[model samples]
Target chain A: MTSLILYTPSGVLAKGGPLKLAAKRLKKLGFDVAIDEAALAKHLRFGGEDDVRLEAIHRVARARPGIALATRGGYGLTRLLDRLDWSLLAASVEAGTRWVGYSDLTALQMGLLAHKKAPTWWGPHACDDFGRDELDEVTPDCFAEAMTGALEAVGFRTESGFDGLDTRGLMWGGNLAMLCSLLGTPHWPKVRGGVLMLEDVGEHPYRVERMLLQLHQAGVLASQKAILLGAFSDWKKSPLDRGYTLKTVVAHLRSLVNVPVLTGFPFGHVPTKVTVPFGVKGHLVVQGRDAFLGWDEDHAHHHPGHDGHGHDHDGHAHHDH
Target chain B: MTSLILYTPSGVLAKGGPLKLAAKRLKKLGFDVAIDEAALAKHLRFGGEDDVRLEAIHRVARARPGIALATRGGYGLTRLLDRLDWSLLAASVEAGTRWVGYSDLTALQMGLLAHKKAPTWWGPHACDDFGRDELDEVTPDCFAEAMTGALEAVGFRTESGFDGLDTRGLMWGGNLAMLCSLLGTPHWPKVRGGVLMLEDVGEHPYRVERMLLQLHQAGVLASQKAILLGAFSDWKKSPLDRGYTLKTVVAHLRSLVNVPVLTGFPFGHVPTKVTVPFGVKGHLVVQGRDAFLGWDEDHAHHHPGHDGHGHDHDGHAHHDH
Candidate 1:
C-alpha cells in the first residue's frame, strides 16, 4: 500500500470526526493513511501557531510519504511562504511524495514551482472532499486513480467555440484569490506560455473580473496559451448588479484578452473536483464542446516504487464527466 | 471662485438624488460645481460603459478644474487603468486639478503615481461622503481647508508606543484591496522609503492579512519607513474565528515586518474621513499617544491660481483631532 500523510496546514479542523472519517475512507481505498501529530493543533483560526504549522509541514516533507494531503484550506499557507524551506519540499517530491490539495495549498504549490520547479496536485482535500456526511463518489475515485498512477488524463466540457483548438503548456494555477495574493511576491511563479487554471468561491463576479483583469494587466494572461476557468461558486448577487453576472464577466474578459478563455472545468470549491497535476506539461485538446487535458502517463505516475499494487484504477477520470 | 467638477468614474449612481445633493452642498461650501455630462450614465453596475468613463476622465483632464471629485467608487477604474492617458492627467495635475476619491479610485491614483509621478488626493467621494441625509462635520471642513492650501497636517491618537518618533517619506496607498489588485502590474507604484497608508471595508481579517503578507513578502513593507493603518471596518465575525480579529492581525503583521505599524487613522469607508494627499512627501511624528501626518503647505495647495478667494482655511485640520 502507498503511504499517505494527512495534515492541517491552514484552517483549524473544527472537529476530529471528519479527519478520522477521511482517514478511514483513504485506508479503505488502499492508502496507508497517517495523520500528522500536530494536524489537529489549534491557534486562533489557523490549524496551529505559525511556527507549529511550519514545523508540521517540514515534518510531513521529511517523512516523504507517497502522498501528502492537506485537511482543509481557509487561509494560513500564505503566512508561511516566506519561511518555508522550498528545498526540503522539493526533496520530498524527488523522493516520490506527491503533495496534494487545493485552495490554500495553491500558495505552497505555486511557491514550489517558483522556487524549485516541483509539481503538486490541485485536488480534493482530506477533510473538505472526503470526510463529509455524504461523500462525493467521483472525487475519491479520481483521487485514488491519480495517486495509483493509472490516471493520465482528465476531460471536461467547455462552452462551444474552441473546437479544433489544441495547445500544450505547463499546467498551473488554483484558487483565484490565493494565486492573486502571491502576485509581485518572490513566490509568484513566472510561468510564461502556461495554461492557467482558475477557480474561486464566495467571491463576487466583479471581484473575479478584477483579479482576472489584474492577471491580464500584469501580462500573465497574454503569455499563456489558454485560460481554463473552473467553478466560481457561492457568491451572492447584489442589488447593485443589475445585469452584470458571471456570464458578462467572462464575455468582458474574452473581449479584453486574445487568449482562449474556456469555462466549465470540473474543479474549484465544488465537491466533484478532478485531481490535476500542477506544474506538469499538459496537452489540451478541444473537440466540439469537450476539452481534454492529458499528460504523459509516465510523468503522471511519479512514484514508480509504489506501483507494486496489483489493483488497476484506470478509466476513473471519466466517471465525473 | 474655485471650479470643481463632479464625475462618476466607477459605480452606477442608482439614483441622481445623491449627486444633486452633493453638488448643492459643495456650492453651499463656496465652490462653483459642475457635473460631468456623463456623470449619471449607467451600464450594468458601472457608472457608464468603459469608453464613456474613459472619455469622462479625459474630458475632466482637458477642462482643468481646480478639483476633480469622483461621484462614487464601486468597480470601474481598474478597467480603465490600461487605457488612461497618463500625461494628460499629469498635465492636469501640473495645471492645478486635485483629483480625489478612495476605494476603486486607488487604481487611478496609483497608476498616476507610477506612470508620471503625479500626486492625487486620498479624499472623500462626492456622493458617498457628502450626499447623505446627515453629513459628517469634519469631512467637508477638512476638504475645504485642504483644497485652499491651509491644512498642512492631520493628527490622531493611537496606542502608545513610539513617543518622540519622527520619520519623513512619500505618503501613498489607499483602499487595501485595490492596491493589492495592482500588484505585479505595470501600474504598481514602486515607492521606496514611503509611509504606506491602508484601509478597507467588508474584507475579513484573514484576507487583509494575506494582502499585507503579499506586500511584506514582495519587499514593499521592508522598504517602507512606517505603515499607517486606518479603519478596517464592516467585516463580520465567524464562529471559526475564535480570537482572530483585526487587532490580532495588526499584532501578527507587526511581528513579521520591522516597519512601525501605527493605527487609528481617521480614514477609510467611514463618515468622518480626513482629506489626505496621495503620492506626496509627508512627515510623520509621534508624541506619546498622538500621531500627526504633515505635508508641506505649498504642496498641499496644488491650485495656487485659485487661492484668490481671500478665505483663510487654516486650523481646520485640527477640528477632527
Candidate 2:
C-alpha cells in the first residue's frame, strides 16, 4: 500500500473537515494515511510556532513516506527556509518521498529547488482541494496516476497562436506572489531555458502586472523558454480600471518580452486542477490551440546531454498518457 | 524666487480642492508655484496615461524647478521606471531641483539613487498634506526647512536602551513595498553600510515580517549600519492573530538580525512628519531615548574619506538646528 504523511506546515487545521474526509478517501483509494501529531497544533494564525513547523518538516524527511502532503496552506514555510535541513529533505526525495502542495508551499518547493535541485509537486493541498466533499474526477485521477508512476503528460486547450512550437526544458514555477517574494533571496533558483508555469489567487491585474514586471526586470522572463499561465482567479475589479485587465497585462508583457506566453493552463486555485511535477525536464509542444507537457522516467529522451543534479536517476521512468 | 512644480505621477487628482489650496498656500508663503497641465488629468486610477506621465516627468526635468512635488501618491510610478529618463532627472538634481514626495515617489527617488546617486526629499505630497483644511505645523515646517536648505537634522524619541550610540552612513530607503519591488532589478541600489529608513501604510505585521525577511535573506538588512522604522499604521489585525503586532514583528527581526532596529520615526502616513534627504551622508546618534539623524550639505564631515558620488563639491554646506 502507498504510505502518506499528513503534515501541517502553514496555518493550523482549525476545523480540518477536509482533512478527515481526504484521509477517508485516500484510505478508500488504497493508501495508508498517517496524520502528523502537530497537524492540528495552533499557535495564533500559524499551524504552530516556527520551531514546530520546522520540526514537522524534519520529521517528514526522516520518515520518508511515499507522499508528504500538507494539511493546508496559509503562511509559514518562508520563516523556515534559512534554518531548514535541506540535506535531510533531499535524502527523503532520493528515497521516493514526493512532497505535494501549492499556495504557501511554493516557498518550500522553490527552496528545495534552489538548495538541492530536488523535485516537488505543484498540485493540490490536502484540505483545500482534495479534502472537499465531492472530489473532482480530474484532480484525484491525475494525482493517483502521477503518484503510481503511470502519468507522463498533461494536455490542455489554449489560445491558438503558437502552432509549430516545440521546446523542452526544466519545468518550474508556482504561485506568483510567493515566487515574487523569493526574488533576490538565496532561495530563488537561477533557472535558465525553463518552461515556467505561474498562477495566483485574489490578485488584481495591476498588482499582477507589477509582479510580472519585477520578474521581467530581473531578467527571469527573458531567460525562460516559455511562460505558461495557469489561472489568476478571485480578484475584484475597480471602477477605476477602465479597460485594464489580466489580458491587458499579458498583452503588455508579450509586447515587451521576446518569450512566448501561452494561456489556458488548467492549474492553480480551482476545482478541476491538474497535478504537475516541479524541477524536472518537461517537453512542451503546441499543436494549433492544444498544448501538451510530457516527461519520461528516463531523462535521455526529453533532456539529452543534460547533466543537471536535479535529474532523478533511481529509474522510476515510464511513459504515461 | 523659489519656484515649485506641482505634478501628478501616480493616482488621479479627482477634485483639485487640495491642489488649488496647496498652490494658494505656497503662493501666500512666497513661492512661484506652476502646476503641470497633466496634474488634474485622470485615466482610470492613474494621474494620466503612461506616455502622459512620462512626458510630465521629462518636462519637469527640463524645467528644473526649485521643487518638484507630486500631487498625490497611490500606485503608478513602478510602470515608468524603465522608461524614465534618469539622466535628465539626475541633471536636474545637479542643478538644485529638490525632487520631493513620498509614498509612490519612493520608486522614482530610489531609481535616481540606483542610477546616479542623486538626492531627493522624502516629504509630503501637494494635495495629501498641504491641501488639507488645516496643515499640521510639523509638516510644512519640516518641508520648508528641508527645501530651503535649513533642515540639517531630525530628532525623535524611541524606546530606551540604545543610548550613547554614534554611527554614520548614507541615508536611504522609503516605502517598504516599493523597495521590495526593486529587489533583484537593475534599479536596486547596492548600498553597503548604509542607514536604511523604511515605513508603509495598510500592511499587516505578517506581510511586514515577510518583506523584512526577504531583505534579511537577500543580505540587505545585515549589511546596513542601522534600520530606522517609521510608522506602520492603518492596518487591521486579523482575528487569527493572538497578540502579534508591528512591534512584535520588529522585536522578532531584532532577534534574528544583528542590527540596531530603532523605532519612533515620525514619518509615513501620519500628520506629524519629518522630511529628510535621501542619498546623503547621515549621522545617527542616540542619547538616552532620543535619536537624531543629521546631515551636512558637505559630505566631508559625516562621511569622511569616502567618495562614491553624491558629494557636492560646490560647498552648499550649512548646519540647521
Candidate 3:
C-alpha cells in the first residue's frame, strides 16, 4: 500500500481540469489520493465547504497508512488551516503516513510542523511533479532512496567556506515567505547549529533580500549553523526594481554573518525538487573532493502509489537524502 | 535649543522655500526647527548629485536639538539607517527628542526603536503646515506645542466602545507597508497590550488585508489590548484584486483573537497628522466609554522657543496619528 493522499485547499487546483489530471497521474504512479474540496471552497465562501473538506481529511486519515499530498498550489490555505483539526491528521500520520508539497502548500506543511511537530516533506505534489524528463537519473535515484529511508542527508557543502569556520548545529527551513511568517511564532524551530534552507517564487530579488534581512535581523539567521540557498527558479528582478539582486542578496547575507552561505541547490518552488526533512539532522560540507551524493535508509522515501508496499523499507533504492 | 529635529530622509523640503517658510511659521508660533539635508541625503542615498548631502553621521547626531523631522518621505532611510549612529543621536539629545513623520519616515522611526529605545512620533511634517490653509491656527498651535513640549496630548476616545476592554499599554504603529517589512525583524515592538495602530496610503484593501494577516499570523496581533485601524485614506480595492476586503480582514482579526478592533480614525500617510509618541507609556481604554490616551510626563512641557501654554492632559485630540 503506497501511502499517498491528495488534498486541495483553495480550489485553485481542485476545479482546474489540468490539476484533476495531475491527480490521475499520481494515481497512475500508484498511490491513494484524496482532495479536500471544502478547504478549497472556503475561498468561495460557499456553504458546507467545511463539511466537504472534513470528509476528505477523514478518508485520508482512515486510509490505514498513506502519505497526504496537496492537489495543487495557489493561495487560500492560510484561511482553512486555523480551523482544521491538525491533531487528527497528525494522529493518522503517526499511525503510518507523511505529508508533502510546496508553494502555497507551505502554509499547511509549516503549520503542521509548528502546531504538532508533524514531520513532512518539501517536495513535488500531484500537479507539479518533477517529471522524468526534468530530473536526471541521479536526482530520481536521490528521491527514490530518500523516501524509503535508504539514506541520511549530509546537507549542502557551500562552494564558499563558512567565513568564520568551525561551527555545528541542527537544520531547518522551507519556502521563504512561509518561513518569514513563522518568525516570532512558536512555529519557528530553534534552528541553532541547524542548517537553514530557503527558497521561494513570485517574489522579486529585493523582496527576497528584505525577507532574508528580516530573518537575519530577527535573530534566526544569526543562530543557524550554515545557511543553504535552495532552488530559486524563475524568480526575477522587476525591470524598474532597484532593490537587491539574488547575487547581491547572497553577497549581503554572507557579509552579515560569519556562517557559510551556499547556493545552487533545488529545494524551493521549483520543478526538480527534493524532499528535505527539516529539523532532522544534516551537515554542511563544501562541494569539494569530499562532496558526492549518497543516500541510506536513515532518511525516509516512498514510491508514487502502492496499495501494497506495506511498511517495508528495503524496496527503496539508495542515493542520498 | 529646542530638542526637536524635523528630519526628512527622502523627500526634500526646500529651505526657505514653501516648506521652510512653513517651518518658519511654526517656529514663529514658538517651536524650534532643525532640518538636516545631509541626514535626509543619506536617507535618500544622496550619492552624488547632492554631494553635500554626504555629510557624516556625527553631523546627524549633532542635530540642533528639536524633534528630528524628515523633510518629506521617499525611500533611502532604511539603507542609511545601518550607517546611522543611533547612540550618538540619543547622546545628542540627552533628554529625548520626539521623532515624527509617517510613510518613508517610518523606516527611521522603526530603526531608531530597533537600534535603541528612542521615542519617535508618527504624525505631520512641515509640508502639512501648508495644507492647513483653513486650520492654520490649530495646526501651528498643536505643532508648536508638540515640538516645544507646550502641548499636552489629551484623552483618546474612539467611537467604537471600549466594552469588554480591560487593558492598558503603549500605542505603537505607523504605516501598514512599513509594518510588513518589519515583521520578524528587530524593528517591531513587543506589541503586548499595546494598542496596535495601523494606517496606509494608496494601498488596496486586499493589500491592507494581506498586511494585517501577516501581522496576525506573525503573532504581533496576538496579545495586543486593542487593534486600532487608522485612516486608510485613498486606499482602494483594486479592480482586479482578489481575496479578502479590509472589512473582512478586520473581521478575520476579531475572529482569531478576543481583542477589541476599532476603525475609522486618522493617522496614516496624510497631512495634519497627530504627533503620536511611540515608546512612551500610554494607557489604552477600549471600553464603550472613556477611551483615553497619552503618557504622563513629570516635566509635562518644555520649551526651547517661547512660553509653554497649551496644557490639556485628557489625551484627546482630533488629529491624524
Top TM-score: which candidate number?
1
Candidate 1: give the clashing pairs.
Answer: none
DockQ of 3: 0.25
For candidate 3, give the docking quality class from DockQ: acceptable
The weakest ten consecutive residues by lDDT in model 2 chain A span A306-315
Candidate 1 Cα deviation (angstroms), residue A294? 0.5
| DockQ, ranked from best to worst | 1, 2, 3
Candidate 3 lDDT over B1-321, as tens digits, reads 554455445534333365656566656656555555543233112221222432433455565355665556544444454566677765644555555677766766666666665666766766544423444344454555566554545334466655645555666778877667776665666557677778887665644655666677667787787777777878545432345466666776777777777775446655445555666556554446444445434222233444333322232343211
Model 2 chain B, poorest ten-residue lDDT window? B306-315
lDDT of 2: 0.83
Q: Model 3: per-residue lDDT, tens digit, A1-321? A: 365556655333323554566556555555554554443444432212434655665566676455676665554555555566778766875665666667766666666666776666666665556322333333334344345553454333345443434434544577787677556555455456667778887665655766787777677787776777876667654433333367766876787887767676657765555565643455444445222222222323233342212111212332342
Q: On TM-score, who's better, 1 or 3?
A: 1
State every prediction's TM-score relative to the real structure: 0.96, 0.91, 0.74
lDDT of 1 by residue, B21-124 (tens): 99999999998999999999999999899999999999999999999999999999999999999999999998989999999999999999999999899989
Give the Å error, residue A129, model 1: 0.8
Please, what are the lDDT tens digits per residue for candidate 2 over residues B226-284?
89999998988887676767877888899888989999888788877787889998988
lDDT for residue A178 in candidate 2, whole number 0-100: 88
**Cα displacement (Å) at residue A50, model 1:** 0.8
